[model samples]
Structure formats: C-alpha cells, structure tokens
Target: MEHQTIKRIAAFSDGGQGGNPAGVLIAETLPGEAEMQRIAAEVGYSETAFLAPHEDGWRVRYFAPEIEVPFCGHATIAAGAALAEQFGGGRYRLYLNNGDISVEGEIQQSLAAASLQSPPTRSEPVPEALLAEALALFGWHESDLDTRLPPAMAYGGASHLILPVRHRATLKAMQYDQAQGKALMEAHGITTFCLVHAESPTRFHARNPFAIGGVYEDPATGAAAAALGGYLRDRQWPHHGEVEIIQGEDMGARSLLRIQISDQPGGSIRVSGTARTIS
Candidate 1:
C-alpha cells in the first residue's frame, strides 16, 4: 500500500540547537510495524511519532530507531506543532499504545508554543542490582549520587531510571558504551537513563542516555522531565512546587523544560517549552 510521507520537523528549540528531536509522520493509514521501524530508523531521531486518522482524533505511536516506545513527549509536542501548523492551532487528542493523552498547540502572533499532558505517573524503587549495573555502565561511584532523591524507576508514559547526581560536573562527565548500554536498557525495559543534578531549589541540569533509541544522548527529554516532576511530587521534595530543567548543554545543544506540580492528588502536571522548526 502506498502512503504519503508527511513533513517531519524537529521541535522544542531555537534553530534546533536544543530540545529533543523527533520525527513527525502523518498519514491517512498507519504503516505496518516493519515499515514504520524502517522509516523511524531512516529518520534517525531519538524518537519518531506516527499519526493516523482515528474516529474523532488520531492514533499515535512512537518508535525509537530500534524499538517502539509506549509514548514519547518530545515527539508528541513536535507532532502537535506540525499538525497545528498544517491544520491551524488547536488541541489534538492522541490515542497511544499505553493510554490517551492530549497536546494543545497555540500560535500567539508569530510565536508558537505547545504543551503536552502526559499519562498518569508512578515511580518504583530502583533495585540495588539494577542501580549498581547502571552506575558501573556510566563509571559512576555511589558518592556521585544525590542521596535525597534516591534512585527510582519512574514512569509517566515510558519507563526511565532516574539517577540524580550530586554535582553538575559528574553529570557532565557521563559516558558509556552505546552497544552495551542499549543491550542493558532493552533487557530491562528502560527507555532512557535520566541523569540529573540539582543546581538550585528550582533549577536543575539533566542528561538522558538514549542508547536504546540509537542516540548517544538526548538534548532534552520531555517524558523523562515529566517523570522527574512526578517523582519529586511523590517524594514531596523541598521545592516551591515547580522546577526548570536545562539539558544538552554538555553536548552544546542547550535545551530547556519547565515542570509544574499541583497539590491535588493524581493531578496532571504541566510540561511546557518553546519549539523551533529545524529544516
């Protein structure tokens, strides 16, 4: 079957220097698994989101170069922006493999911003063995960890291992063998390894190793950022109920993410940022 290959633009940055890059593929009918994977691999972004017409909205699926993820926020934001630009600014509901989520795209004059609400979030304690393996993979010692945050596998739409480091330097100097890390992540059902360091009460630095996605690192990770916010809310971290994440600086791409947590139980946290089109 022939399908129209829509334009794919990288979002959430200025000149595509920062933020996670995603592939936005729009088609009338969904492609098969093998074909979708091929397209995603050719696109070669951290994640590629496929959108097809549904009853009233759209059905979306996110695929890394190698695997299909339950959901990907950066890709969703990028797709939303693409759709808004194509069909005009509005809200889009997406039916994902994991659950239903929505993204709203707005154009203020010439400036555009997109916000995505992630799936319900929850976190589980990181197993000691898993933590140790991850630490060894990154060549990090236990002293490098931020004890207050502890270690946990958090999930918003996809599962991520949150490893908070005590210092920015430690977070910056992270390294691992891509093949080995990918094997481990695939084996453990991990989408990304989120490395973070608190710079202040409300400011943080982040790095995401996305070996399983065929990327060395992500400049910005929306799903991971949401997961982190949910994790902090769950722990009642000593914050003012909001946080800003700066990522990709170490790689010279520089991305920004803003997260807001409410007092209500099981509330939908807000993840907002600016996205610029990258040709």
Candidate 2:
C-alpha cells in the first residue's frame, strides 16, 4: 500500500465555526478497498472520500471508520471543495457504488462552497416496530414526536430514519449510548438517525446519531438534510421549493445546510454548504 495524502476539510461550516470534518483523497488510481478502509479508520473522521479520475468524471467511494457506505453527502461536498482548490471551481461528476451524482464548487465570499445534486430521493413509512425501537433507543415516547412531520425512512443517496420532535428542547436533549445505537441502527439497516425540529415550513434544526458508522453524532449531515428535503417534497409540505437546516448546535459546531427540492416526484434534491480546510 502506497502513501495517500489525506486532505482534511470541514463541511457545512458556519462562518468557520462549526462543521463536520471529512477526509478527502484524490488519486490517479484508487487503492484497494482494504487500503481505503484502513486509511479511513486511521483518519478517524465519520467518513472519508476516495476519488480517482474516470472517463468523463471521477470514481468515488466513501468509507467510515468501520465500513464503506454507498454515498455520503458531506464528504462529497468536501470533495468538491478539494477539487476546486486543486483544479479550479467547476462541476464534477461523481460515480458512487449505488448511483451517479454531481457537485459544483465555487468561491463564495472568499470561502470554498459546494453544492451536491443528490440521487433520486424517496421515502416510506417506518414500520411501527422499527419506530418503537428507535424511540426506545432515544428514550422518547410517541408524545415527543411531531405530528406534522411524522416518522419515516428517507433516502437521497443513502437511507436515514427521520424522526421529527415536537419541541426544540426535545431536539437538544438527544442522547444515546453509542454501542446500543450502533446495534439498533445496524439492525434497522439505517446509516444515521435523523432527529429534527421544525422552526418553520422552510427552516429546521437537526441532530444526527451516526453510531452505525462508529460515530457518536454528525455535526452536519448533508445526506440526512437531502433526505429530509425529499420527505418534505414527498409529503407536499409547503417548502416553497427550498429549506434551510441548522445542525450541530448542541455539539458546539453549529453547521448550516441549504436544500433545494425539485417539483417532480422522486426527483433529485440539491444540498449545499460552505467548507473550509482544517489547519
């Protein structure tokens, strides 16, 4: 295994305050899965993205400390920023294990910002049993749930369980044992548990439990944000075609994410945020 340079960047940052860290590696030829996984574990970020030049775009793969996920939005955003830094600002095609996506990078107010066009988005009602299990994991009951958003499994590039809490305090009090969370999430085949509170039809706050990937929580989750946007679109919620998300406040890494939804059914959603290189 040859040495691979890892670029560390914070995705979805808020004026350089808070964001999720991701490792980005751009190579002429990608290493094997085992080596990539090893590097991701060594980097110890929630996710790391490996990129290699393809015919028209780039071959991309995402790896957590423990496993390889089909897609990761925050990592993709970081990758876009890295591409911009290295190759100049432009849109880059990304080929993932599950599907293809695109990301655009540019300099915004002298900061690196990127937007990702997600894969086709969809959602389905969470089974009663699974919902109950999730609630138990969070130590919450049905009364804590927000009646408007309800509970469902949503997907943009990957899958997440979306649970809408009724109050902001409920969202802030989110806590869970990492081992137990990992078990529950793996059993349900979910990557992250998205706990959200709606400030308005177009504004939201979120907390994501990502124990399945050996992470306790994600400061900013672009994938989950895209999933939430898709769910809102699917429900015909009055989003006016766009939504804003504030996440990781409780973690002291207040990150920001913006999502734009298409009118077509199961259409792709766009998630955008600013990223900065870690010192």
Candidate 3:
C-alpha cells in the first residue's frame, strides 16, 4: 500500500487554542480496513477520518484506535477543513457506512469554520439495568442526574449514553476506570458517555468519555453534541432553536460546540465548529 500523508487538525477549537485533535487523510483510494485502523492507532488521536472520491461525492470512514465508528463529528470537521484547503470552501457530501451526510467548510484566516449535518437523531429512556451500571461507573446516584434531562440513550450517527447532571461541579469532577468503562460501553454498544450540565436553556457544559474508542476523553465531541440537541428537542427543552456547549474545560482543552436544532423531531441537527491545523 502506498503511504498516505496525514493532516492533523484540532476541531471545535476555542479561538484557535483548544480542541480535539483528529487525523485526516485524503487519498486517491480508501485504504483497507486493517490499514486504516493501524493508521488511526499510530496517529493516536481520538479519531481519524479517511476520504476518497466516490461515484457521486466522497466516501468517508472514521476510525478510532480500537474500532471503526459509523460516523465521527470532530474527524468529519477536520476532514472538511482539509477538503476546503485542497478543493476550495464548499459543502461536501459524504457517504458513511450506514448513511449519507454533508459537511460545509470554509477558510477563515488562520482557522477553518466547519459545520456538519448529522444523521437523524433519536433518544430513548435508558434501560434500568444499564443505567445502574453507568451510575456505578461514575459513582453517581440517580439524584445526581438532572431531573429535567433524564438518562437516555441518544444517537446521532453513533450511540451515546446521555447523563445530564444537575450541577456543573459534577461535570468538573468526572472520572471512571477506563477498563471498566470500555467493557460496559462495548457490551451495551455505547460509543461514549455524554456527561453534561445545563447552564441555561441555551447553554451547556459537557464531558464525553470515549473509553470504547480507547480514549479517556474527547475535548470536543460533535456527534454527542448533535445527539444532545436531538434529545433536548425530543424532551421539548427550552433551547429556543440553538444551544452552545462548552466542553473540555475541566480537561484544559476548553473546546466549544454549537448545535442547531430544527422544529421537526428526530430531524438532522447541525453541529458547527472551528478547526485549526496542528503545527
């Protein structure tokens, strides 16, 4: 196989300072699955995106260190940034393993602005059995959860267990055993643990633990953000149309994600962020 050059970009950056890093590779042809996994592991980011020209638009695949995700938001944003640099700023259609989505990218001085239309979102009340295990993993009790946003399983391309806390302090003190988290997540097909605290109807704080992906945490998680937006819309949370999330501050990365929700339930949510090339 020919060597492919990887571009490292930080997606959802806050003023070009902090964000989640992702590796992006644009090749003439998509590499084999095994090779993509190896490259993603070697790159050692939360996720890596591979893109190749397809019959209509483009083929996109996301790989974590341990597995291939159906879709990944931060990596998609990073890929969009790369695409803009290479093919000019515009919207790019992407065909994923399970569905099709689009990402718009445009150069903004030293950074890039990217937005992704996620797959239709949905959420269901979490099973009692799974919720018990998740609470134990985080040493959180049911009372710790925000009554407004009950525990639920949310999906935006990938599945995430949403655990909205009542206080921001709870989000700041998030921790868990990586091995145990990985085991539980894998067993339940959960991609990440989306920990959140709502500052207001339109503002939130988040911390996503992606142990299933062999990542302790993600500074910025676009998929989870989109999923949360959908979940909130489902519950009729007073979002007023959009919500701004501040994530990774407790991790020192301080990333930001903006999610736009439509009136239609289970509709596609738009996740927007900025990307900066990693020097």
What is the lDDT of every predicted structure here?
Answer: 0.84, 0.93, 0.95
Supply every candidate's count of residue pairs whose N, Cα or C atoms clash at under 3 angstroms: 1, 0, 0
**Roughly what TM-score does model 1 have, to 2 decimal places?**
0.94
Q: What is the Å distance of residue 229 in model 1 from its true position?
A: 0.9
User: Can you rank all candidates by TM-score, best first?
Assistant: 3, 2, 1
Those runs of model 1 whose alpha carbons end farther than 4 Å from true positions after fitting are 1-4, 14-16, 108-111
Instruction: Please give the RMSD to the true structure for each candidate, in Å.
Output: 1.9, 1.2, 1.0
What lDDT score goes with residue 223 in model 1? 92
Superior by TM-score: candidate 1 or candidate 3: 3
* Rank by lDDT (best first): 3, 2, 1
The residue-level lDDT of candidate 2 at 235 comes to 89
- lDDT for 48 (candidate 1): 86
Angstrom error at residue 118, model 2: 0.4
TM-score per candidate, in order?
0.94, 0.98, 0.98
Weakest 10 consecutive residues of candidate 2 by summed lDDT: 1-10
User: What's the C-alpha lDDT at position 43 in model 3?
Assistant: 90
lDDT of 3 by residue, 1-279 (tens): 433489999999998799999999999999999999999999999999999999778999999999999999999999999999999999999999998999999999999999999999999999999999999999999999999889999999999999999999888988999999999999999999999999999999999999999999999999999999999999999999999999989999999899999979789999999999998
Worst 10 residues of 1 by lDDT: 1-10
Per-residue lDDT of candidate 2, residues 15-43 (tens digit): 77789999999999998999999999999
Best by TM-score: 3
